[model samples]
Target: MTKTWLIYALGGGWGHITRALSLGRIAAKHSKVRILTNSPYAHYLNAEGCLVQWIPDSAGFSATCQQVRHIILNAECDRLIIDTFPRGLGGELADILPQLQHIPRILIHRDINPRYIAAKNLRSFVAENFDAVIVPGEGKDLPFCDLPNVHHTAPWLIRSDVDLPERTLTRSHILKVNETIKTILVCCAGQAEELPLFAEIALKLHQEFPKCAVRILAADCPPNCQDLWISHHPGIECLAVADVVVGGAGYNTVYECAALRVPLVAIALKRLYDRQDKRAQAYCYWVQDIQSAIDTVKMLVDRIEPQKKPLPSYINGAVQAVHHIMSYKF
Candidate 1:
């Protein structure tokens, strides 16, 4: 009989989906795998051979329990992996994990380190839920080694099968907006608080370089922020035409930018589990101050430059994660 698995990725579903797809791709070779997320990127996942389940953001426990019931009845997965729990405005969703304890379940944490020290209450709550925890990324910063069943694992790299399309940089795609002399791609996580700040920075950057444009490739951004030269999209196809890319210092962005060989201006956002600092440290060359409005914009526009290293050979998170999962014994 074929084994089955369910991967839940709700918070910042783009990253979560990317990470989970890596595992699913690998798992699909031997086991039936399904991916669950609340992002619009769900369509991209379905085509990859994994069944896609769309979970709404901050869905209550009852709703999720119904989802679990469907999975158990139809797929009968042997393993259930959750990417993160108690996400912002998604805290109420944590109730579903504890309910899954009777089954084989694992929590996959990609936050460089779990935010336990600073987020005591939140950490304690999560500690009680799952049967095991998997920490991805360099384990240098994690503090709790004595915790039972906690496993230290490296972050899975992605490898895509889809070849990127060849396209020329359209002159309209590289217009000068702010006084900055370059086309900058804002690669943020699409959080609401940072959207306005990014838009303001883009407006300011346009003022500095009226001939340039600031393009945002994120989800859920507000309109009419900077009437100047700002545009938004949900894919990275345009990055092919950009001169510089502005984004937070997440692992996905770092590797993606390096893989694309695009110049970067990165801001480090503080996350629930204090993982931002370490992520910033890993990509320090392009780090920006998330708190300062003017400085943030300037850091992206004035200093953004090409990476010193050779472009990465691959950016397929799905392929890398899957390869590692298949090698995992249990």
Candidate 2:
């Protein structure tokens, strides 16, 4: 019999959507997959061959709850995979847990911060509800590390099909440019509010290092902040060729840089739940001020070597996660 999987990947930003896409693509090979999300990236999921149901951002609390309930009760998927938030984005899943208790459910609990640890009800809710919790990558100093049913795998990363030869070609092209011109890739997260800050940093870097060419990987740019912007470019390709990569301390970006062995300078952003500030400290260089970031980039641009180290063992989380999900008996 063909197994059916219903994946709930609700949250803001592209991280949730990308993770879902990575796992969903793999799961589709063995089982039918449908993604339930409210992210704008839902269209990308659809294009990538997963069945997607877009929950509008403007959806009210009752409507969101009803939609989730309807899908769980009617979709009849053999199992459920809930990503990130266990209580749903707006606590919509709380009302449907009783109906789903009999079904086999897997929760992808990425990481928990101090705020989450302080939420007594949230922790208790997850403990009582989920059959298994999969923590992608290395375990942090999180409160939920000791959960009996929790499983840890390699860092969950979106695998790229771009091969070594292609990456080499891209790198060669970048290096062929004038030796005096230094190329910097500014990779911001998919949040509009963060773009202006990055733009300012880019301008400062350009002003201080006049010989350096700073390019931003963004669809749109702020009015006052100006720099060469490439609206659409493959992230891995950009990372491979650039002299340095400056980005927010999101899990996906950090892991991508690590996997590619790029010289990374991370700027910790203020996220309500995800502890980017804490995560940034583990990387090569982390800065809060624009001036500090500029200085760090300048220091590392010439000294940093292209990552030649073998990919870390923890990066195989996608495959390991699929294996666990497929092997579990409902």
Candidate 3:
């Protein structure tokens, strides 16, 4: 019988579904892959051979939980791939864990604040349920609590050859802000409220570096954002033109920048469960404040003129993750 692998990617930001899709895209080639996500960005996200179930706003907490549980029961999936949060965003998976013990249960473990370890009793929850915990690259800062089944892989990046733009056209899209001819790309997910924060950062960067063409890449842009705010372009395409990328220290932004050899100035955002500060530090990023970000980006941009810093060895974490998941057996 063909096995169905259901991935639980219940998170608010684009980061969760993006990472989940990276694995699902590959896993779907081997078996049926179903992604359960709540991200607003998941509306029309297409992954071949994978079914994405987007949970909408329900009445309240109980309603959301009931909806999630109903989906799992109906899915009849042979495997469970939980992203980040071990027991779902609101512990919805806890009730179904015992019922699903007959099949494989895995986790794509990323960075988390240590406080959550105690607050959620994640150590015990994971030890009892998860057969394997796959830690992608940039996850060095995560506290694994000595779980015997923990494994490591490269970073889970979303860009594939199909997503890349034509090399000839890439250079044409970048407009020069001034004579310096450098590009500083500030990026974030398509969150309307997050737009102002990144927009302000882009404005400040333009003030500091007048020569660089500063641009903001958000999936959804307000018309008033002026020429600087670019919408509808894939974030990966913008990375091709950027000399430096400044953004919140999220999983996709950090590793994708690293994978493409783009200089990143990651500023930590206050996330309820995620600790961006630690993720940035794990990658040797030193931008703790906006001023520090400015300084670091300036240094990298300037250095690129004379010589570029040698990056660490490039490893395809997403490919490695696909291998582990597809090769695993009972």
- Predicted model with the maximum TM-score: 3
Q: Put down candidate 1 lDDT per residue, 148-190, tens digits, no spaces.
A: 7566644554443244333332334433332323665666554
Compared with the true structure, what per-residue lDDT tens digits does model 2 show for residues 103-124?
7888888765667657747677
RMSD of each: 5.7, 3.4, 3.3
lDDT of 2: 0.71
The TM-score, computed over Cα atoms with residue i paired to residue i, of candidate 2 is 0.85
TM-score of 1: 0.66
Query: In model 2, how large is the Cα lDDT of residue 254?
Result: 78
Supply the global lDDT for candidate 3.
Answer: 0.75
Instruction: Give the winner by lDDT.
Output: 3
Clashing pairs in 3: 154-317, 155-317
Query: What shift in Å separates residue 159 of candidate 1 from its native position after superposition?
Result: 5.2
Residue 45, candidate 2: alpha-carbon lDDT: 37
Summing lDDT over every window of 10 consecutive residues in candidate 3, give the lowest-scoring window.
305-314
Off by over 4 Å in 2: 44-47, 60-62, 138-140, 160-165, 168-182, 221-227, 305-314
**Residue 95 displacement in candidate 2 (angstroms):** 2.4
lDDT by candidate, in order shown: 0.56, 0.71, 0.75
Using all chains and alpha carbons, the TM-scores for the candidates as numbered come to 0.66, 0.85, 0.87
Order by TM-score, highest first: 3, 2, 1
